[model samples]
Target: MTQHLTIVDHPLVQHKLTIMRDKTTSTAGFRRLLREISLLLAYEVTRELEMTTTTIETPMQTMEAPTLEGKKLALISILRAGNGLMDGILEMIPGARVGFVGMYRDPETLQPVQYYCKVPNELDARMTIVVDPMLATGNSSVAAIDLLKKQGARNLRFLCLLATPEGVARMLEAHPDVPIVTAALDAGLDDHGYILPGLGDAGDRMFGTK
Candidate 1:
């Protein structure tokens, strides 16, 4: 992956995002919308995956079939909120290898602190995609990607529902080679490190937490 940022401007993605931003939307509704939007985002994120052809015997005759090249894709969820996006993408690419990087912000410092991590072997051989709902400070996202790279992940991409300018800049500065795919890039972040006009705390909204 190269330094890139793709904003998913599809009507369906935007519509669902609008609903998710509504404060009145129920937890169930928010979760449902997230799943639907993620599938749309997944479509764009994997659009350039390499393909190879192989001969296959069809019902009518023999033909060459185009299939994905390289190792099975590795999907890394940044934990908690990331699970929402991960589940949807998994529905579309069920064959992908799954992993998790558990991290949380230190309320005082707003820095990411790793709590857990589990990933597949041979990360250097697969296309790894990291999923998260919001990219506010980008500290956690960057930290997650750093960890993945340490584990040998090379071709990596970052996917999220919303992002702020600060977060995007931070990611670019830290890992320019990793591409970013988001549904919307909001105006900026609030004082509390939340994306302005964002759908509040993604985890709280999706899980009905206060």
Candidate 2:
């Protein structure tokens, strides 16, 4: 991708995001909105996927059918919150291979600490998309992408619901080749590195936790 970042400003995406940001929105409602937004984001993220034609015999005649080229897509969810985005996208692309990178941020330093990782094989051949709901400090997202690259993931993309300027800059500096697709780019991050105007903690909101 030529551009390093893409903001999906679709009307529906923005409307749903507004609801998700409301503090009064219930957990079930938040999760439902997330899934719906995910589909819209996935549509943009996969827009440029290579296509190939294959011969197929129809009931009346023979024709060439257009199909996706290259290996099956690999989706790497950045643990708990990423699952919300991944779950929705998976429903749209059920054939995609799924993976997870588990990590947590240290409250003291706000750095990412990885605890677990399980990914698909032949990473070099697949189009890998890493999903996360929010990109605040960018520490965890960068770390996750670094780990994936070490595992041979070459063609990669990052998808999220919201992002801050600091996070986007950090990601570009670290992994410029990987394009970023987000629903909205907020003003900036708060003192504790949380995204300002963000929908609170994505994991907590999605799972009904603290």
**Which digits, one per residue and each the tens of the lDDT, describe model 1 over residues 87-183?**
9999999999999999999878889999999999999999999999999999999999999999999999999999988999999999999999999
Q: Residue 183: error of model 2 in Å?
A: 0.3
What's the CA error at residue 20 for candidate 1, in Å? 0.5
TM-score of 1: 0.97
Off by over 4 Å in 2: none
In model 2, state the lDDT of residue 57.
Answer: 96
TM-score per candidate, in order?
A: 0.97, 0.97
Which one wins on lDDT?
Answer: 2
Which digits, one per residue and each the tens of the lDDT, describe model 2 over residues 40-89?
99999998778999999999999999999999999999999999999999
| CA-lDDT, candidates in order | 0.93, 0.95
Supply candidate 2's per-residue lDDT for 101.
100
